[model samples]
Target: MKQTIRLEQFERADIRSALAKMNRGIERESLRITSEGQLATTMHPAALGATLTHPLITTDYAEALMEFITPVSTSITTTLAQLRDVHRFTYQHIGDEYLWPLSMPCYLNATSDIRLAQFGKSHVGRMKTVYRQGLTHRYGAVMQTISGVHFNWSVSDELWPLLAAEEGRENNADYRSERYFGLIRNFKRWAWVIPYLFGASPVLCKSFLKHSSADLDFHELSSGMVYVPHSTSLRMSDLGYTNKEQAALKITYNSLDDYVDGLRRAVFTRSEQFADIGVQTGDKWQQLNANILQIENEFYSPIRPKRVADSGETPTQALERGGIQYIEVRALDVNPFSEVGITAEQMRFLDLFLLFCLFTESPELSIECQQATEKNVNKVVLRGREPGLTLMDEAGEYSVQERLAHLFAEMAKIADVLEAESSAYHRALQSFAPAISNPDATFSAKLLRMYEEASKIFQHVGMRFAVEYRDRLKNSGYEFYTEADFQKMAAQSLAEQAEIEAQDKGSFGDFLAAYFEQALDKKKRA
Candidate 1:
């Protein structure tokens, strides 16, 4: 079946006006560590509020690893402003600690040294910690500590019905869901471009390679810096967040139902490798379960179809109740060049690229095509800017520059269709063209140049940026939120967390039983 409407149809629909009204949110993750660049031993700052209930600040895998989330905003200005406010407030609260300014982590001693994020005595809170524990057991703690940015985006509500009509489909949940799946397929195909343009994690501390089995021909430089020549984002490569077991999952984006089904099975199916870790090591819980996935969130993908879950609902349940609310772009590396880890121009370009994906014809992805996508992504991640490098496509091999040139041409049409601040989109696209023509213009290449010129290691550079960013935040002041507002939210979040803990009436064992039973029942019905 024809999966997507033609580009000509999109022009006829005149989606330009509707495209200008899209909403976006950003989730940025960073490690809060000591001045000496060691992981912070102190607990999550009390002034930052309860990690369980705080709307903006939370811990990811490690207690020291902080995640800043921005509320949905219609404009990149508001989104970035809110993100800065969160950072400013956080810097003010964290004592003697600095936010790690790079996507790759700083110096680390051992896996045991990294403390797991602790939640209060509530079962749900404990469950969250246990899930992280599972991640640690499956993937080493070093991999979990590596942080990045996630851009959550959705088109305006009005655009969806119009898009559905263009495809000769009903303006309903299924139609919307299918169209989103189409967007996802195209995103996967073109996502390699992201790393080529914005990837910043080119080098790393030799300590990170301690637990890794990567056999790349790395050049060992002075001060323990190790890197592969022309590498873009080691953070997105096999050296970063990835799993061999997941490769076997072969999760399909052909339909929402298929995607959810694949996730459900992963969560339920037991892994013999993980069984060795055991569910519990004596009194302490080693992990939530021995399943391949402890929860739906465990399935790591570069992009995900997301819906905000209601209270007491799982992610899968939320998607079942309401189709995808937004698409989360996870391929972004933390742009070390920006104080805030992302730029307004980058967001503008992303909007244009996503719109292009939505309007472009997306073929249903097969297993072979999926492998091709992975190959292309790895090519970009490892050696993207290499001159004369070619990427595979159904049409056959094409040079990286040629493919990007073609994509930018399409994106230019998308930029024109977008009404507000369209020049930002054009400028962003224009900036990437040079990176294709001259690899040295790429962020990774530029970062390497900076490292070489400064004669300092990644850790020293990261610390300098961290201090600079902290000072900038101190002077700039909050943009979207005030000190009083932050204090009020912090207090409220603590009280809510307390209330949740107080309301937990059942034992952890009973909670586990009920949760698994419900999941199994849901699977049977599906």
Candidate 2:
């Protein structure tokens, strides 16, 4: 059944303040994962700069905290950025990757374009080496960045017994069954829960851009992510709300440039026009980019997961081959600085770089590449410590050094062309080219070169800031946040959902009543 929640009479500024505070919370929570004795950044890099030693923790701790937060509306009024335009403007990726009605690869190649494959195979091994070199040269860590993005999950004391029992089981099937799809299933039924419910009165949505034969769906990746209010340093309107509600806006962007501009207007605005208005948009795009690149299944596609001819193998073999799913890019953190969490300069560079991915694509989705990507994801998430780890790409694998050099040279070429053509975006891309070209000498490298530079405490600030911002919006402005508000919204949404679910069946109210009654009966018996 679809469940919706509304935030009524909610102000926006308060929510913004709360979210800004949350940055610190994320940093603090990550501290628990680091080795107690170590004082370096938990985010490790190939070198001390990019990677840092950290510990293992579950998201339950974070989820519990989020529950206390509020949500808001974004569809109505959140003037996003529209900074200096760039060349080759393109917005949301135009691809055959839709959520439903399965959009698969077509002109880009359904099975695989031989021309692209030929180009890819020719450079597969070399590309692999360059990917490593390029990453290390720039960041020193094989894994680029740990994303601020997140999915939601809940596990309470009541489930401890089941958790304990599941650990004892040989495989994690039982645990997976119980926890995996709860959030995704919820999204499929109800999506509008995003804006209609989020406001000073009520409150806060994920999807994929691709369609793999038998891979993970978009919802599966970021189900816990609900619409929290989005406010930037530019406009703390969201902070006006007392409730800690976050929100999202589904906008139409013509090109990547448009998207970047949108981000600037939405979250990262600090112009003279709004000078009278106090806003606090930070330079979150840099951080957001780092996070997005590493999403489980976004940019890098090492091994294709599809129902290949099921060959008989060991117990694990069957599950792996048949387990067709792709990674998705969600869990993106809102950059209070930018509308969509990134900047124009950053976007300009990213467009050129990401395009290179499409141009020099690989033919064989090698297991090694997939493994490398997995390693990269872990390395970035847990701190990139694996020495000499390679990034998967075309032109064969190269040591980190070799791969980076080639990228530097190629980027230079792209930059020069843009400069001559006088493309505004190309110029932006060109400017960053030099810095990124010599990533070996940038702050990115410093991050990996040094250990424990930033305090974990700072990381946790993002979440707390989110909550506080919501509170401010509700208290100072027209927004409101309280468990009571959630209960009311949830109840209404749940009721509506129940009705829909009962279609062609029994009454949804009856189902809930019986379910609750049975639960009470079970409790009494116990």
Candidate 3:
């Protein structure tokens, strides 16, 4: 069966109207418990934002969205404490727990335009990841190339539960639980992402994606997850769900039978499976989308290369052949100080911001675009907000701060359209505009202001995380660290790597050359 996914935009009437209707169910308070198992009475809103809660969604007064407001929260504070406060105010739903440490954002089919965010057909092998050992969803599985554009809606369908379902919080006479969604702005360490940025992926993120109840003749099952023997490797071709012919003829994650069926399920009639016609994203929505392109540019802020085939082929011809069709947008910075993670204004702005990326309508970068990206990165790092810091023109030609100003003005107009649609989205847009206006609003500057220096920021956040983890483990009566955890894990891992390298029997450059050779060979075979 042939399957294609499309980004589905909702009409403003439908989008806003649905949100408005849903407003009746929005909770204004949090519902969490103290270690004593009694309600924590003496707490501030920021306290609620920082608390770790379970059961993803809730209507409890202790962990409600309205309790954390995104409507009117903008400040010039740089301390992690303050940033954390605002973040908590925005994303009380996704607290520090439940953080999935994956290199890329979990791929969620948002509007049809999201595919455009990945590029129509410019990403291929990027979609699939292969571990040195065979696995599909862990350290080395294909991540559906989804880099996030900050200040936008979340990009995961899994969010439906947190946003719509009240998981726990039963037996409260004051209120009834309803499906509720809130901003999720917890900024966790991104070790999973470090490898990707360093270009070590399709090699790391391939572990288990599914669990089978039992083991087989080739492998044994343990702890609900199928064990992958260390002796084997899972190739990219092994993960392709393109069609039956490309399936590797062997099931790795699940039994061959189960794998084949799962593939069918993910692809066949996928349109029907994703049948939730978004409430309504109308003309105003499109206006808000395209307009975001004019104002604040966010995509240009982050660096991520979209891997395309070196072979010369027209975009049209490549699409026909299912060639390079991937681009991962990685500009979003973790709201490093937020309790909840991020804020509503950030989310709303992001919705428009992402559309802007998709609609940038850019093709292959001219030397100019490449240089522009380099210049922007430099400016962002050192002089992000030095009055009239310079940037490139839309044509990627001349360098001019006036051009940057002009771009900002145009983007502001788009943001205004978004503001016109819903007070929620509009307010969110206006709230974050100041940050976009200067470096002070960016996470980096705020971080500097917080600790009074870069090193201090790291120490403070690091200590905070360390303290939190210690407390968590202590509370759970668990071991936080051991000799193996501290030292042996790394030593053992490196030793294992040495062994693998020894068995491969190649020099460093030779290994890289050999890897490419095998990759190309596999591609040609497929």
> Using TM-score as the measure, which candidate wins?
1
Sort the predicted structures by lDDT, highest score first.
Answer: 1, 3, 2
- Quality of model 2 by C-alpha lDDT: 0.24
Q: Taking the tens digit of each residue's C-alpha lDDT, what string does model 3 give over 73-171?
A: 122122223323332322332333322111122222221211211101111111111110111121122222211221212222232233233334432
1-526: candidate 2 lDDT, tens digit per residue: 1112222211343432221111100110111111111112212111111010011111111111100111111111111111101000101111111100000101111111111000011122222223333233223221121112221112222333443453474323333322222222222111111111111100011111121121211221122211111211101112111111111222111222232233323322222322332212351111112221211112221111111223122112222323211111121222322222334444344333322332232232233533343333323222111245343333454443344445545544444433323265456555544432343333223322221222232232223333343333333322232334333444454454344334424433343234323322211100
TM-score of each: 0.96, 0.28, 0.33
lDDT of 3: 0.27
Clashing pairs in 1: none
lDDT of 1 by residue, 1-526 (tens): 1123345655753565776888999999999978898778788989989999999999999999999999998988899999999999998889879999899998888888788998888999999998898888889888998999999999999887777777688887677778888899999888898998999988888899997998886887676778789889999999887877788988999987888888889988889888899998665888888888888898888999998877767787777778888999999999998888999878988988888788777879998998898899999899987779988877788888877777778888777666566787889888777876788888899887767655553346778888899888878977889999999999999999999999998789788778777765442121
Number of the top-ranking candidate, with lDDT as the measure: 1
What candidate 1 gets wrong by more than 4 Å, as runs, is 1-14, 456-459, 521-526
Regions more than 4 Å wrong, model 3 = 1-326, 339-344, 360-364, 394-409, 412-421, 436-438, 453-461, 465-518, 521-526
lDDT of each: 0.85, 0.24, 0.27
For model 2 the local lDDT of residue 365 reads: 28
